[model samples]
Target: MARPEPEGRVRRFSTAERMVHRATGYLMLLCLASAACLYFGPLAQLVGRRHLMVTVHEWSGISLPLPSLLGLFSPAFRADLRRLNRFAVYDRQWLRAVRRRRKSPEARPAGKFNAGQKLYAGWIAGAVLVMMFTGLLMWFMGLLPFISRTSAIFVHDVLAWATTFVVLGHMRKALEDPEARLGMRTGYVNRSWAQRYHSRWLREEHVGDLSERRTVE
Candidate 1:
């Protein structure tokens, strides 16, 4: 027998949230691509292209943090962040389950942002801040002492490598989870999808209302 399709309005991300996410995504790609070329390959030797790429990379890096700041002004994003960033006792258990996924797939319950996702968010935030400060020092090299410039460059390179690895992992996870991609693409997930992956967020967002019940079933 065919089951009835779930009924309820699927909560969508706000336009502000989507916009900021998209902007940051584009800028991060730009920065990473340019940085990659500059860091390795003969591509950097193409006349003035290296310098131009560096300029674009630097500006894009500078723009990366704007989205999160703008997103903070959004009540929804702010609220989501509050929930997503809270470290839970269960998160370690979730992490353990993920590590043992081959043995017990059903043991791990998906979440709005899993333990891995939360860790990524915090890492990226810290990395960007460090990169911004170091980039600034590099940009205004002569204003600071030689020691500062040298140290900043060292830190900048280190953090850039760290970000590169983190972004690669993020991309890999997104590829592995098609529903996660769809959620971002459509700005909505099916009720089952939400219940399976983001139940806590769904509950928190729609507590004590007819909407919450509708969303669960």
Candidate 2:
């Protein structure tokens, strides 16, 4: 069970959602930090534990999907996954508005996830899968005699850099929206924030009855 939203706020993320995000984010940070130590010669020397760093990096990347997999057991997480999968008419309108560099949350309303978010989610999901695959291949070159370890390493390195940049960009974007960060952190967001950026989602919520909702259950 959960407490009521604050008067001016509404439930945006469920507890399960926040837990999964936090778990995945922490694991990702671990992987990136270990990778930085492993990949950079100076850092590797400074860290001075090559074998330990390799072990940490390998295991962290391998565990990256576990939080998301476990989250599937949560009804709230499953519901949000469905939301992330669907793309409606308003999603297209949102993308168009984004390309034109204008804010039209009302006319080009967005649901729980806008087009850009959906794309980013899809891309990061795919990238993680690819990274896992390539990383495994690199770790066990003997497992695939036909596949070149060099090629696997190349792809892994490229994707790692791309993921780093994309993650940095994501963080920068999140910093621009304090309400969004608050929603993810505390499971509630100001009603006005939802109305401005996720008007469609706000409309779908029972705004008047938020006090009756159990946001953390």
Candidate 3:
């Protein structure tokens, strides 16, 4: 028998969170695109057009971190982040199930953000910090006389490569998970999706209220 479509509920991402998230995404994309062209394309000359691309890249990188910081202030995002950061005993089992492609139809469930999402969030945060430090050093090489300019360039390049790889991985994971994308898009998910991927959060947020109209699903 075909399974019925899971009923949708409300209570998803807030306007502020969504706006900040979208802004960050755009700025990150701008930074990456400009940097890539400057580093690996014939458009490198365009990078030197009044140092346009470099300036854009630097400013975008600087701006990208702000949205995430602002997101922390949102109660919804804060609550979600807390749930995501919680390290449950069953997370290991989830990892194993993921690897083996053997997650049972019935199993102990997860919260708003899974362990993988938490790890990704942590990694992106670290990457941004590292990139900012290295980028600043590159921009102001003479300010840090203790470190040679050549060494600063090397470190910046290395971190840039690392960030690129990590961001690509993040994009791949997002593409692979439709519900994950949908949650970001409409700011809600079907009850079944919430139950499967974020059961703990659903229970906490929507206790005694399963009707879709009662909450944002």
Candidate 4:
């Protein structure tokens, strides 16, 4: 179990997990930017570097799963993976309680990752796989039928837009919860933050660490 750094905080992300997150962030941004440059004529002309943009997007897409696969080498990373895979009774309740925020009793015993977070993780994992498959098909256009290549490009473009929307929504929610960011960055979150946002997780994982958070000061 990862613990706080002596400030009464609780460890939320391991160093390995943070590294994977940072790598994913950078790679996703690179993929998005380079794809924009390659797909948009105006942007391609603005940058005047279509040659390099294609290479950047291709390699970035190819590397999207590297960080996650590499992070499996860490025990903490593997443990977090298991936790994300496990959806308890509280998880379903947490999903229903989203609109109610903390007003619902179901929100009281949420584990480390709420239902939303689990869904997001699952979603992005599937999205990445889709992107990678379509990207490979598009890249090796000559190896496949012309219609196949066309289909891949169409799916890839649509998923690009979908992923953009999902990421933006995630960013908006993260902005509303700065302590969640702190947990990722510092590997710890104030105990009170855990209590409010993830009471059951704190209580179940840490001994004497469940400090209920009512409001932020």
Candidate 5:
């Protein structure tokens, strides 16, 4: 579903993918904001609704992955997931370049997701699962006495802060890559963007498009 558009644009994210992304972002924000109100003393009093905030936090956390889960029903979404999961030799090169903080793009054979994006995706997925598990434990502490409520709180708080900083860093990078943001907004990116950071991907897309055209002919 992600292909070249008319003019000099290429599709980056499909509309469904963008919708899933936006929904998940909103849910995550709701979870964070509600959690802050429930957890912080001043915020809790200022909000004057501990019970409501707690309910919102619990339900929002539970629903955080709902959009992504529903998106898997789309075959296009599944294929995009495959691309994200398939790391290549060039991914390793890119990781090295990132560790060194190379001043320029390393001319690595990047795919739809660069190695950094893939790694971040993997991390966030794991973090979400952990948070969910710990949150459920804390929500129903009496159900599982074997699990330490204190430990769950500690892990949840730590991961919440970790997720916050990681997301902030991601946002900062997104600010630098305005085209990437546009791709998510409108499901399309400039063709030159593909050539610049993902030349290998651009070449592969061209070949695939050409083959498809021939097949159509």
Candidate 6:
């Protein structure tokens, strides 16, 4: 028996979660901007200071995982990570509905993290690790004689472009859902929005509430 949500609002993300997301997003933006300046001749000349841009790009990429790694210390973030990692029966249904281009929210009802979001998170996590590995290889080419510098650079470049497009798509989708975006930005979502799109999560929250109350009693 959870208490009623106040002002039709319910907690969506913890402060730790929001902080990690913002830090990671800022670092990713920095990495991408610097990468563009390093890779594009026109932009490189426009920005000048090739040496400085290279240093920025390399360090930003290297630091990309720090926020997430630190966030793991927070129980709330770790719980969300578990949610993002696992897919349920509803996730499969959601995917099928998506493939059929179902436009209604009911057709794509999800828990805390949807099927598409889970996939994106998984893909981006893998991409970050791969990018970091290739970046290090490129940065210390002489030290890593086993790995080819040219190959590392090529893979890193292609992945950077792919990641950029995927991030753009993610942002576009976020923009379309103002309430969802607000949840990430402020850590609270309208209760009705959660009921409509994340009914399963709402139910789970209630169950946890009941369990906590029972233990206290």
Model 5, residue pairs in steric clash: none
What is the lDDT ranking, best to worst? 6, 2, 5, 4, 1, 3
Give the alpha carbon lDDT tens digit for every residue of 1-217 in model 2. 4576799998988888999999998998999999999889999999998999999999999999999999998998998999999999888888888888877566568888888888888878999999999999988878888889999999999999999998888899999988899999999999988888887788777653464455533
| Global lDDT scores for all candidate models | 0.77, 0.89, 0.74, 0.83, 0.86, 0.91
Candidate 5 deviant stretches above 4 angstroms? 1-4
Tens-place lDDT digits, model 1, residues 75-190: 97897687668878657767888777732424544456767888988898889888988898889877667557778889999889889888998999899988777667766667
Q: What is the clash count for each candidate, in the order shown?
A: 0, 0, 6, 0, 0, 0
Which scores greater on lDDT, model 1 or model 2?
Answer: 2
Tens-digit per-residue lDDT, 1-217, candidate 3: 3233336754557667677778888988898888887787667765556378888989998888888788877887777667666778766666767777775633535666666677777777787887787788878867877878788778767877887888889889889889777878867667777777677777866664555546555
Please, what is the TM-score per model? 0.84, 0.91, 0.81, 0.87, 0.93, 0.95
Q: Give model 3's TM-score versus the native structure.
A: 0.81
- Clash count for candidate 6 is 0
Q: List the residue pairs that clash in candidate 3.
A: 9-216, 9-217, 10-215, 10-216, 10-217, 11-216
Q: Write the per-residue lDDT of candidate 4 for residues 43-86, one digit (tens) a residue.
A: 89999778888899999999999999999999989988888889
Tell how far residue 118 is off in model 1, in angstroms.
0.6
What alpha-carbon RMSD in Å does predicted model 3 have with respect to the real structure? 5.7
lDDT, candidate 5, 1-217, per-residue tens: 4344769988777788999989988998899899889778998899887888888999999998899899999887888889888889999999887777774665555888888898888888899999999999998867688889999999999999999888888889999998999989998889988888888778887899899889889
Name the 10 consecutive residues with the lowest summed lDDT in model 5.
Answer: 100-109
Tens digits of per-residue lDDT for model 6, 42-157:
99999999999989998999999999999999999999999998989989999999999996878997999989999999988999999999999987768778789999989988
Better of 4 and 5 by lDDT: 5
Residue 136 shift from truth in candidate 6, angstroms: 0.4
Displacement of the residue 5 alpha carbon in candidate 1, Å: 13
The top-ranked prediction according to lDDT is 6
